[model samples]
Target chain A: MSQHYYEFFCPVKVVAGKAALEHIPYELSGLSASRPMVITDKGVRGAGLLDPVIEACEEGGQEIVTIFDDVPPDSSKEVVRQIASAYREAKCDSIIAIGGGSPIDTAKAVNILVSEGGDDIAAYAGAGVLKRPLRPFFVVPTTAGTGSEVTAVAVIADTEKSVKLPFTSSFLLPNAAIIDPRMTLTLPPHVTAMTAMDAMTHATEAFTCLAKNPLSDAHATAAVRKISTNLPRVMENPKDSDARLELAQASTMAGIAFSNSMVGMVHSLGHATGAICHLPHGLCMSLFLPYVLEYNLEAIREPLGELLLYMAGPDVYATTPTSRRAETCIAAIRKLRDQLWQYCELPRTLQETGKVSEDQLEAIAHSALDDGTIMFNPKETSIEDIRNVLRRAWG
Target chain B: MLAKRIKPMALQARRLYVETMFQVMGRALQAVSEVDRSVQEEARALPDGFLFEMTVMPNGPKLVVEHQGDGRFQYLTSEPPRPVDLSIQFKHIAHAFLVVSFQEKTSVAFANDRMLVDGDIDRAIRMTRILNRLEAFILPKLIAERAVKEYPQSLGLPEKVLSAARIYLKVATHFVETARAS
Candidate 1:
């Protein structure tokens, strides 16, 4: 156990594998919820991913009261209120969120409004604000990355204020998470690579950060091994259902781990960089993973060394001496990054992204220092330290 | 009956420690808001009239401070007040003792589910930064390094000694004035 005292709670009933989508209506019926409101974006619907979920619900004698597929990539407070209105007007008894982080987060925010009886979400925009359980909710993630399906937090952009309002409560966790391979079969190779890297980063940071304990460590290691072994195979063959399923499950596992143990500087920097330069989140995670690990090397040396066993198989772990295992684990991540770059031109550096300039590093660093996750990092990072890491990661 | 009696006695001791710590913390925060550059910068980032509170739940010592803008914090009463901008409440007296005695860092306490914050997280994070800076000045390096996420590397021994002395003097003077007023 890394921590002497820790608390881990994941109430989400995860129903994964071949017929996970088919089980959604059964799960809903069990919750005594018959009229579900489906919240998703046009992209997931355009790709025809929502079809199976609808079919399953229809066949199970459930009525989808309404399908609001207009969720944006970056959901907003206004969007949440709009969805809440639709949910009420249609008399939805439950919520089934489909697609990735944005839609799921939107659904969670909508649940708060509908259940808590408020149009102003800003009134309830902090940690531990919700006092009661939300309406029955379920998530079927289309993207294999965000793991937002199981997290007890949601972030909705308050555009007028130009800030992201975060709501965190155990009440925000989904009643169940439905993970199926069919949802991710159409994901492009680059997306597959980047999202897997996001999961890998989540697991890696969870295992190494402060607050890590036995239970979260178990989930983190399992997630790391799954992503490491299966990411490359999926990158080679995107249509391979087994690999896709493993990656999706790994994403959820990583989500559960980080949600319990919390993530550290990699996420801090990723969030800051995304906020500043408008970069895709998965890309930012892939870009900064190695540099943040290297910076946190001394403070997290023991856990990083232990992670080598999961990142690379037993052959590599058994051969590397104890002192060198930490760096070797980082080297393995770097190799994976190189492979991802080859597979789909994922940017490995801030300079390569062509969106961020040298001057933006300071802003990113300032923003990163203010991020909540920075407190959980094993090593205390200074603004100058973050700037130095960004400079190193720039080229 | 003996076990029940002993529990209250133990609770009384822990409550005193927490109360004393809260008073000292309130004074130190008032001092740092005036003297520390980092705290001044952080305070400027916060909205004016931001009320911050630290307390133990269900009936324990409380410390409330109001930001009066221009990097100034006025220590409010120890009594619980209306909802504030940011409030960090230790779940139990023992948890407060762990943090007040420097046995556990603030972030560690949060990770252990020993405390809960009710307010905007961004403002809460800034409040934490201010607290970290306050801890760096008020506490000895060995102890502060454990209490805070990062002890300032810029403060040499001489600077730390001088800062601690200044903060401690303010804390003592405030307590003396309060005693006279009472």
Candidate 2:
């Protein structure tokens, strides 16, 4: 219940829906660039998602001067430095990143070094260090889970030190975020479900966290409603392009929502568990989400009630009593977890994650308290509270 | 020596804010801990030799506070001070004020790139909680609402008014004594 003086910012131009990639040239043209460097991971290329970017370049009468497709899953400073060198050598004017969070982040880091002329990215580790806007950059996210396409910060792994270096600036935001369903159409059902759930977590946390504002609430609510309506359809039929588009839009909207408002303890816990246990981020999100919702149940009941209405739609929301609506939201997420688990073995309990041991719970809790997202949790969490949440999440 | 390279007029303005922040933070360390046990509890969670420093971008008038054993904190010098624990450096004067003036919370400042921390981020977070308690005691309801991540749900109106006034008196007394000694 802090003050009403929340500042809002989202500078990335979004092009979402069918054939959005085709519109990339127009967006780049406005930035006064035609020759762009295409950056992606080998996985996205193997998945055939790069075809659209190639097709768009061909149709737009522009050729990518060079392609750097070996971006690692956890983007490293060395990788970014190398990519910056290649971009400079090829005389590329702009950057086009096509993949999930890693490539988008790598591209952002490379853009920083390429534009700012720094050999070491660690120098730009903290926020506001970059003095000006980076080179014209765009992101084509192949996965719906990480909204790195629209986010203003990049967390690139420091392979040497085994830590993630965070680079943040309004300047780090991409000039555009292109969300084409065609790009994410080939994602497997498990990946689809997990990423969509990740978007849902972003929206939920944004709506309920201490930083929740009127504008962010609107976007988060819309994102939750869209994800609720479309996640099932996309799960039932993976090829449903319409459902895919809605999920993509939800992910992007949720990204904008959380990046501005920030997420809560769920993300803090998720980040710790994921980093420590080497679990996938979206998968961690889906597992810890219900437990977090339950933990913040009383503190965020009003927003939880509203989310119940959004997730369940009008008909069910009407019948649900005010006292029980928050529980209803938690139950619905539990149901989704059960379904996703049945489809693909997504662990519902922390104990179910074979990688995590009982002994590691204390370490996870301690690490979570350090995470930047912990500040936004509605309840000021103590180490004990974190441990308790982990204990409940454990079983 | 502080930012000697900055323009004189700009430096003067920045120093006003910096000096005021120093006075306020010093008062908060003493007054809030006296009134609120939560501040003490939060501070007690940190290790001894914990240091929190604030310096404006490109500059002088930097302030560093170190945690004395138990839950007490006293201001220290800007230099190594036994290998500092947590340091928040602002990129510019306006960026520093964004948090100092209670316009944004520390976490929001971190998220927005308004400030940077160079050591022990978890310990930094623990220190932030302690700072939040001080803010509740020092700032009025309207101003505290922006600086604190979450306003205390149960602190009654009368005590809030009483604590803020107490903090103001203590801050004034602190500055007067420092001026006399100087």
Candidate 3:
């Protein structure tokens, strides 16, 4: 119904495949940068992912001034400030973020501070605030999740205010996202399953949300089909480089799709859950996918019907009546979660996580209402409505 | 001292005309939607104390409509008398008039990055539904076809002429009152 007006933007040049890691320096050369700072987290380092990145940089003849690998799970403004200070001291001309969401997000904020020459990055909060392009930046995600590589939005926690500040603009997008399957080869099966489901949520919710347009719809549908085909294959063999590349490409496409159309209540509730429980974001995303689909079913049955056609091939799709498409989509999502749970020991409910407590339900429900993504959801999501969904998903 | 220069994207003459038109339509819509035997159930489903604002942004010449709880709305003065619960902000003057001047459909304008919503989503939805009701009354069949998701039931030619005349007369009276008060 909201098809009346929409605009899509994804300027990130994505390099995806087994050999993509070797091309990072060439791409950075295209951005005219020779000295780049490598930003990562301890988890990525402990997993021995940073060594290959360093070797590849050396092989590309690009100088690395410093490897600042202190990013926490949720990047804060203070951390970004510190990272920016390091970038300056090292005289790095560009940033190369290697890891999951946190390092990529920290690099985005650091680019803002370093380029804008502002000590108070908080002044750049909210949507459309960044007017100028940022320093040449790139990301190499270690997990097939969070598509932070291509999105034009960054969430940095304001440790002082105890709130998350969202900075959005075309400027926040990275110059390139290198998706080498080697980057995620070390990722555990559980992380692979959960993050793949997160990508599925992004693809499905982007398709069904109010901002859906022709361009984003194609990307979202393609992302869903890719994730559906490759998730189980990667789960079966975590070391398969080809399967890893497929899932990684799926995340990038899904990220670009959701970045353009934005997401709906699944993301809103997931953010609330992650904020309240300090749980892994992908776990929270996978847990809420089916429930949010059902909640939005009545309002967006047409889009959901279309998604059923994407997720389920024409064989099953043709047999199902048009009226049953929404149900089929919801069932398919639940089936996927069940498969992941049985195969990988992934938690299907919030209680199974053991990090989330029953007392946190009210706070999660209240916080979800404050999340901005709910605005794009096709259905009206009230606080009571979020509370009910949380209760049902709480197990 | 530097003189203040107006922003290039500031709301312009066309936007003012659009505001004036909405002021007229704000008063006319409730009565028109309430006309007997209309099945646009959502059009007349507005709650009491609801406030809708159309702001031409980043700075705005904002126009507001407040539901009076009697199946009617009144256009408040340039400065709203009360807090606006929902604000639909156009990116600039060009976008503001594209819908306000009937050159583009409201929904289409929204999809085209012509506008942004800054407040409650539910109230925005309700206001869009109400605006469609007014569009049915105000716009010609060709324009209304593009504007509304589903066309409201048609009024006969004889009734259409009479209703249009009556609605404009009431709108004229209200517009004059607004002008004098301002």
RMSD of candidates 1 onward, in order: 2.0, 6.3, 8.0
Could you give candidate 2's per-residue lDDT for residues B1-182 as a string of tens digits?
35565667775776688677865786667666566677777777777777777776677446777777667676542364476667777777776666787777776666555666776566777777777778876677788888876677677788888887887777677677777877
- For model 3, the superposed segments whose C-alpha errors exceed 4 Å read A1-3, B1-17, B21-54, B58-60, B63-88, B97-112, B116-182
> Using alpha carbons, what is the TM-score of model 2?
0.83
| Model 1 lDDT tens row, A221-258 | 99999999999999888889999999999999999999
Q: Tens digit of lDDT per residue, candidate 3, span A50-142?
A: 888888888989768899999998889889888888889888899999998889888898999999997777888766677888899999999
- TM-score of the second chain for every model: 0.92, 0.82, 0.75
Name the candidate, 1 or 3, with the larger DockQ value. Answer: 1
What's the i-RMS for candidate 3 in angstroms? 5.5
Question: After superposing candidate 1, which stretches have Cα over 4 Å from the reference?
Answer: A1-3, B1-7, B78-82
Q: Against the hidden true structure, what lDDT does model 1 obtain?
A: 0.89
In order, what lDDT does every prediction score?
0.89, 0.83, 0.80
Docking class for candidate 2 = acceptable
**Which candidate has the top score in DockQ?**
1
Candidate 3 — what's its lDDT? 0.80
Residues A1-395 of candidate 2 have per-residue lDDT tens digits of 64345668898889887778888878888889978999999999899888878988789987888999999888788999899999989999999999998898899999989889978999888756888888999999898878887788888888899877888788989989998989888899988988999999999999998778888889899999999999888888889999999999999999989987889999999989988888889988998998888888899998899898889889878999989999998998898888888877778888787878999999899889878789778877778889989999989
Per-model i-RMS in Å? 2.0, 3.9, 5.5
Number of clashing residue pairs in every model? 0, 3, 5
> Candidate 2: TM of chain A?
0.97
